[model samples]
Target: MRAIRSLSQGARTSLRQVLWGLVLVLALPTILVAAAGLYSGYRAEQQATDLRMQETARALSLLLDREIEKSVLALQVLAHSSSLARGDFEEFYDRAKTSGLEEPSWIALFEPSGRVIFNTRVPYGVKLPNSNRMDALQRVQETRKPYVSDLYVGSLTGQRLITIDAPVIIDERVAYILSLAITPDVFQGIIRDQRIADGWNAAVLDRSRRLVARSRSPERFVGQLASPNVQEALASAQEGLLQSVTLDGIPVRTYFSQSPTYGWSFVISIPETELAKSAQRSLFWLTVLGAVILGGILLAVLLSRAISKPVDQLVAAAQTLGRGGEVSDRASTRVLEFDTIKRALVEAAAGIRHHEREREEVLAHMAESEARLRLALNAGHLGSWEYTPATGALTTTPTCRAHFGRGADEPVTYADLIAQIHPDDRALQKESVALALAGRTDLQAEYRVIWPDGSEHWIRVSGRMRSGPDGHPSMVGVSQDITERRLAEDRQALLLHELNHRVKNTLATVQSIASLTRRSGDNTDPAAWNAFMDRLHGMAKTHDLLTATQWQGALLEDVLKNELEPYQDGIRQRIRLRGPRINLQPGAVLALGLAVHELATNAVKYGSLSAAEGKVHVMWAVTSGSGQPALLVEWVESGGPPVNKPERQGFGSKLIQRGLAQQLGGEIKLDFAPAGVRCVITFPISTMASDQSGAAETQQRYAS
Candidate 1:
């Protein structure tokens, strides 16, 4: 309102004067255009309605022809009856009667001249009526095919019927004519089933334009001729629509289709009342156009009043919103454009209010998230950056600039970031970024970055493509100095490879020793040599268990089970093992594995394991002895032959007694008492830290 009031009028004429003249000039063409629009719409609706009607007629025609074809097919099948050729009238009569012919229908045979041979409706050898359907038989004889007759009164039945005739050719000549006569009532259901709307009528008509079936008053119109308009249409075209009157005297627009097969027609008639709807719609448009032309006279006056109301409402709504208030009142307008503007203003104001609330909430969340992000980036030494392609601007934090070998005060560019990359990785980095852009995937590159001091460091740059505020492509990402982590990873890989080589060599030596022991053919005691081989296998199994943990440590129960599981064959409760979960350094895993193997071998040879019911219980747990934590594993045997202490300690006994206590700084007690052989191994529990390979080295060294 303020701006409009401030406008300077350079001329005397107001906009009303100019528009009043313009409306006078354009009113003639405007009327023409509106009339044309009305005509076009009515014509389009009529064309669509005509197409639908024509299709319905065509479909119904085909349906009626198909029904007649069914009768023709039945006649053809019955014509091949052997009874007809042999002149067995009684058998042929019975055959035709029981040939599944429809009720109120009959099959008959006639000579080519239409003399009746037999009729199924009468008894055998009875004098039957002469066949009066010679025209259909002549058609069959001439065409050498089946023929369908138009609606007619049958000479025998004395009722309106249609005939289907097939030629029973004998010796390449028309021998007999087989006929099936069905009443026109068979087609009444088909016409009625169309379910056309009220005031619309559908029908099936024979070739002579006589009604075979009618949807409206079938009893009155059936067998009667249609109006002349339909007859004239059939003469000119196979399918068409005509303005005519139905046989019942209803004025209608009729659509008709003639069947190519039976020369019959299907006609659908719509009352003129139904077709008047399109005309009514056209009249409605004409009235609206007339009102518009008259309304134009007041348009300039109304627009002048209408424009100011909406404009003033818009100003009022803006002021209310500017003052943090809501505008919800609405008023009617005479101009359509003003009404549209009012609706738009209402919806836009509501949206702006909703957006303002959402914007406040989002800004709060963003501030909190940004604080957490700053802490994480500083703690992890990550360098953040954002690039906008629209403005071609690269903005980075101080850390990102430092990552690219630039001072905090220096400006950075994409080219500078690329130039600082090591030459070997520069091309690869570019290729990765190109792929990221093309595939819409994240950009991740690990390459060497050369600092300004000429010292090389590995830097990993990661980013994701996003859309900027201007809807152009942009990137937001972080970079980090991963030089220390990369060095550690390299060192770890080397150490693992070396450890694997050493473990394989050690296991190979143990296998060689076991093989040599197996081949000790001259040994006096076979059990002794086999026992040594079994111990070697136990060590190899323990080695495998330790390797699964990267040679760091293993479970104590796992070590004992590996050595004893093989001896638990005969299932008379031969062995039982119980232990709490406890981890042992690799040295303890190896040493305890050997001690358990010797005890199990002895049990099988002469201890509890020798008896079918003999069993060994192996249990271990952590206990405090002498103010230090120690792992105590007890191996007890029962239900075996009596045992006694050996006067001279054998190799197994000496190794268990000496090697475990000396190398692992643990105590071992082997008691060869009378009841069973019992051994207890106690070792102080060691730390389960990652850097415990030295312990495994000692065990492998001792075995070698």
Candidate 2:
């Protein structure tokens, strides 16, 4: 410690000695003034460089966003093209090749079952892999909607691409899937116009972290996971991020922006040295300025010392007088210039103190302003962030932390924010932010965030990117809780879906009832009419079962057993009934149950179940069909008075043949053999779905 103190003091003493010796000579003043001027000029130039760099980053982000949006638009156009939907492979292929569109681009169609109908990029007879459509086909077929898939390598073309799938619905059912593959070259072209400094690069990445295209290392880097910065940018998808990394052994600063249309991340990398080069120049000038200033002070001190030697002698005599040792009367007769020199020193000390006080006041005011600014930002729920396109350091505001469900005191950055966004939404959010940063659009999005607490919340964020003096973007935005709003909207959508379902069931019920009334015979035979009325009552009973359930659905077993209860007393011992545990749609349930009633009534009066020796058997089972499942049912009878085929079809025949067949999408077969009668019915599983309860009631009303 003593050595360090001694060295500092010694250095100070040496500096003073040197200054006292050099007077303000021509050489000292000239060098000092020139150095000071050079330093100021360097600072001005550095500021200009910063401004240019910031602009470049903003421009790059903008160009990337435009390219992505263009891709999305292209996909949409291709999806709606009638030729693409109609499987016009030859026309599509020819159009793609000759329409000035980029080559290797293709349009393809897939069936809801994942069968590829046609692909322009593939040979006319060649089959494309079914796996590519697996996920998309299921979602589109099941939900009947359009969806976008993440980037994948084309099994046919061997090129990395993203597929956009939209369902082709005909008669309210998905008929086919329209798909288009966007190649990486399209992304490459997007960044081609981006102006990157020498030794820098840019690229785009899909959600899987795969580099779809690159402006620099194009062919080599394709299919590789992007650098962490790119990953971060894709993850946030809403904000532009900057980071630094070593690429090909060269240290580079990278900026990442997102593409909303294509669900891609755009990354731009430049060398740190390029951005800091101006600062370095300024530093050099500052050094020179310091030297010159010191030199000027030294020169002035030396010149002053020479001129003040007489004043110093007079001060020495005054010190002697104060000590009671003064003798020379001439000491009081000091030169006028010497007296002026002493007065000037005293006034300069006072001025320096005054200046220090003023400087303190200015600093205090600045601190107060900063505090107020922070408070205002907090109140406004604004999150402020800064990214050095050259270094990748991202600093965010407290409000941003809260909005993202991070602790207010936790240190989070752009990369950290990106990591928190849901992967499905990250790419889109990043793209929007990039566009906003590029000044293409204002950044806005609703995204999901998984907080550290493991709870998820929806946030609606809106922000804008402003180009810094260095041309890089600084982002500022607000985030608010939209979780409740989104959930409510979802609930309303669900209720509407349920309502639509109920209305359809009701309509089917009305149709069945109308058909039954139309098929019933006119009131000419009193006995026949009386029997018809009894059948109608049975159908009415089924409708009651359905209406009680509000059309949600009903159990097939419950409806069937209820309709056959009256016949159980006399024929319970003579009957055997078997069927799967299943639910039924209202239309099918009512139709099937009432049709059963008609056959039972006919049997009790004239068929096998009519005699003491008669026996009746009923059975049902589920089986697979071309699409979902098929249900097969049989009713058999034996030991009746006599078995005979009906010469003419009656209401019973029509109900069993037409109503059951049409309503259940099933076949009804009746056989009159020497031993007894047998009836078989086969139908699709949809008929047995829980919503067909009203069908039974429809059939019952036919007797009325």
Best by lDDT: 1
Candidate 2: tens digits of C-alpha lDDT, residues 180-279: 6777777677667555445677766666767777767688878877766556656765544455574455576565655554455556666777767766
lDDT per prediction?
0.78, 0.67
**Which regions of candidate 2 fall more than 4 Å away from where they truly are?**
1-104, 108-183, 205-212, 217-249, 253-267, 275-282, 288-704
Model 1 Cα lDDT, one tens digit per residue, 38-122: 8888898889999999998999899887888877877877777787777677787888889886567887788898788777777
- lDDT over C-alpha atoms for residue 222 of model 2: 81
TM value for model 2:
0.38
lDDT of 1 at 101: 65
Measured against the true structure, the TM-scores of the candidates, in listed sequence, are 0.40, 0.38
Clashing pairs in 1: none
The top-ranked prediction according to TM-score is 1
RMSD of 1: 33.4
Q: Model 1 lDDT vs. the true structure?
A: 0.78
Off by over 4 Å in 1: 1-34, 81-104, 111-127, 285-704
Give the C-alpha lDDT of model 2.
0.67
